[model samples]
Target: MYQYSEFDKQFVRNRAAQYRDQLERNLAGTLSDDEFRPLRLQNGWYLQRYAPMARISVPYGELSSEQLRVLGTIARDYDKPDAALLAEAQEKQTALGTVPVPGTNRQVGSELKYGYGHFTTRTNVQFNWIPLVKSAEVMELLASVNMHGIQTSGNAIRNITADHLAGIAVDEVADPRPFVEIIRQWAALHPEFVFLPRKFKIAVNGAQEDRAALGWYDIGLQLLRNEAGELGFRVQVGGGMGRTPIIGTVVGQFVPWQQILNYIEACVRVYNQYGRRDNIWKARIKILVKSEGQAYIDKVEEEFRQIVELDGAPHTITQAEYDRIAAQFAPPVLQRQPRDAAAQQVHQIIRADAEADPGYDRWLQRNVLPHRNPELRAVVLSFKRLGQHPGDCTADQFDAAAQLAERFSAGEARVTHEQNLLLPWVHQDDLPELWAAARKLGLARPNIGLITDMIACPGGDFCSLANARSLPIAEAITERFQDLDEEWDIGEIDINFSGCINSCGHHHAGHIGILGVDKDGKEWYQITLGGGDGSRAGGPASPGKIVGPSFAKEEVAGVIEALIDTYRQLRQPAANGRLETFIATLRRVGHEPFKAAANAARFVEKEVA
Candidate 1:
């Protein structure tokens, strides 16, 4: 909810102008694809398999209702708004019974109206379309809305993420929003940090729950109070996902809140100067941490910290500035009355009509959350379904969600780290009517926190760096395990998939993690069990015993079935009976049996072949 300052506005406008110039040159043949590749990438443009894909950063996965409405308008006006567009165009062309003459300037049927836009697990939005001209138009439109595609796809600093619950969650000791905003401004287009060896990500978490997924970032800062009651951040460095996945090491302890930015700048300076640039694969900060050791990285960070501190903490933020940023994110006002009777009536109506509504029960459990205010509830809706690409909500769907939030939920919608949309402050009494409306918009799927609620990366489908197509495999697994009751029985599980070791889908943090790898030009998956997220004693799950080199795509469901069955037999009973508890139970039983069962499925397939 941070409003763009005049400085921010000018920054985006200048960048837009520069991009327009670069694009025009490329179109005019003044720049070759080789020359334009890095330039376009810095501007968030990519030429993928199907078309050109542009990634727009949605800083910290937070979007204002107005900003979201703008995105919806772009999708509707620019991209192929519906799947039926292509099919409908084909039908009309066939009706005409002949191809249109090539020289005619008149527009043909459905001639590539921009590209489809999709959300990624990394707090970014991507637009894919052919004929780069339309994509540029989309970029210019976004700039007018105070948004830009800068640094989203490059080796430059990517979107800065913070706890999604920042400012709203009462448990937070101190809001990290100010620090996040400060870094966002400083890092944007910083000449020293741009064009680093590899992509860099930073996250700040102020709550006990680690909503920012601190362990997966290059720089993870956990804001906390020290024993003396002074606010500070515990800094973790070199944690990243790629070919070599690592949970960051605690490099600096108790960096004072005011010195947070200085410490971060120091860390980046060290990585920028020393990080490998010769081999792209070995260039990540994680690799540097591995080769040079944490002790050495700590030494460099300490040196940089001293220099910055000596210069009177160049990035030190004042209390008033912090208040200004925090004020922008103040929680919306809530009604004091108890649950409205009319809302309860609607809930009953939907529950009673279960026979007529298949999604009703799922929506009730998955999409809705209890609020401290008796009259109000928060609705958490999953965009991740069995066959649909996870996190890919259409523009119209975005607008519909925004409208619903404005009408029923205090004019706000929250985007969750799990790639779901949230109506955070809806009145409990409105649940039934809200559910009914959400159902019509195709936002009523209720598989949240279930097996069907998968986290997936674009994979080989779009990303040039991926080894395999992750979305298709995720769809296959979801379809293979489509029974809602069975999924419910499995209970609160995190099943995450990544196209490669980068773990963009957060495979390293799932209760059940699946990572895609390339094996002799064939797509293979590596399964790791019992990973968890957050700041609790349980962090990223330990790398489980490798289950297989490869398994038939269809056999993945069977492999998971065998693993789940192993858990059922081996797990010790727990009071709450959560999957995490079951996983802990299995850890006690050891992983050998689970690995044996999962690997057995793959072995059988090899023999059949």
Candidate 2:
């Protein structure tokens, strides 16, 4: 993990103090709401549906145990709405009524939860109930740990994301964290690019697997070595999901690693100069690239040439600077011996446990990942479980995760793109003990890539931009798939649920996508199939195809069930003699069978006015 220098620490402190002054002025009526709104947004404060939401940047998904503890403190001490405000919000929620769970007499509860942090797909932490009045205090607390929410919101470059297994992945040709950190520093508050046509996101993947879902980012950089054995990047641009979902096109086959920043500068400059500003819907770079096609790439290439030939490539990364940053990411020293007597005994015990206990075996199969160091494993802490919104961790859970990280992972953790926490440096000998501890904390659920491990956003329950509530649908689907045997049988699947077209939940990347829609002021849902996040689970990066017209709210769970059943019935055995994945089957047979099943699953109901 990168440690903050004295200058870095002071910079954050100063920013916090500046925010306090701005917040106080806004409260004192010297600064109007219109004048203060952009300032607050720059500091990651948003006036959400019922309260203020704070998005804290976790650069490249890295966090130290100390920083995690402070996040826990923020959750416990500051993520609270005033009592009167909470009462008012609850009253409004009651007036909205509830969506009944299909085939049951029960209705989804309209409960408002606070005192927790939500880990987003972009590897940022969000608090939904933080009072705007106390936001300055919260910013100061974050600054103490060298953390902040700078550029996490607004039409600026957001936090840079990389594969959670960046440095430790076995197949990585080069570590992406150093570049990710460099980009984070460079783009944090660049004056010229502070307000682009729309918000931009960048993701990097160093390993062979596309763990960071690079194709869905505004800019996707994949580190690789060419035939000449020189390290470089394959650059992809214009990927995003909103009303328009697109897979980024590869514009640069291999740009030398030294000129990545320069190339990126050219790319963004073109978008900034030509991207639409009049229409909010078409402001994103994706829209520009889609509409312009090869012309966009030609412009970017011309800009790159101008930057390199005429401007002396000012942003080129020098070898010395790269080494300085890379040094911070050197593998942490381990305390355990791989072949010691105690290690052997633990290994034997693990083997015995796997032979005897299916739960332990399944946990190993799903959660434990291979590390570059043979003596260690990267372990995922599952957040997708029953009775809670996906990616949400209470104050106590945050503290417990910190403790676990300290005990097993060298005081470090990474927030995965799939909305889970990963202890990336756990010793192989400690798996049994770590599993037992994490299980006690309710963080160890062996459903990493299964049907139950769905991704969901905080929908209409919190986001003012939402068209419908995503939590109730997520909860209903989670309840429908609680049986461990059944979930494992369903195998690897990604169910991404978003409350609206903003695609915060990454519904366009899931094998099965559920998007909340509004029909004549009533809640409805649109289902899509065969979407992949450029991973083996769904194969390549592509947006899902909608099955048909939107269905009523109560029909979603049944439709999902019907789609899964359709897959189970039609799937054929693969070369490995295992049942083909839902995506593979759907792709082979096309969407008609699944669409038919989904429509048949709908129940007769009175139309809503």
Clashes of each: 7, 0
What is the Cα-based TM-score of model 1? 0.86
* Alpha-carbon lDDT, every model: 0.71, 0.88
Off by over 4 Å in 1: 80-115, 333-365, 370-376, 535-544, 577-582, 603-609
Q: Model 2 over residues 1-609: C-alpha lDDT tens digits?
A: 897779889999999999999999999999999999999999899988777899999999999999999999999899887887677666766776543211111134534445789999998999988888889999999999999999799999999999999999998988999999888888989897999999999998899988889999999999999998999999999999999999998989999999999999999999999999999999999998989999999999999999999999999999999998888787777676456898788767766765587788899999999999998999999988887778888899889999999989999999988889999999887888888788888888899999888899988878888888788788778988999999988888889999999999999988999898888888889999889998767589999999899988778888889988998999899889998888889889998999999999888433321
Residue 33, model 2: Cα distance from true site in angstroms: 0.9
The superposed Cα distance between candidate 1 and the true structure at residue 144, in angstroms, equals 2.5
User: Compared with the true structure, what per-residue lDDT tens digits does model 1 show for residues 1-609?
Assistant: 566778788878788888788888988999887998998888788875444677887777666677778788776676542455435444543563322211111123323433245777666777654346666677677888788787687887888887656665556777777778778887888898888888998888887678787876788999999889999999888887666767787888888887777788788888888889999889888888778886656766786658676777767777886777777666677654554899667667775675367667667777776554566777876687653677777777778877887778667666677777777677766777788788777777778777777888777655656666666667666776778777766766677888777777888777778887777766667787777666342344244345546565446667877887777777655666544444575568777798888887664432111
Quote each prediction's TM-score.
0.86, 0.95
Name every residue pair that clashes in candidate 1: 115-129, 241-502, 242-502, 339-375, 343-429, 367-380, 531-541
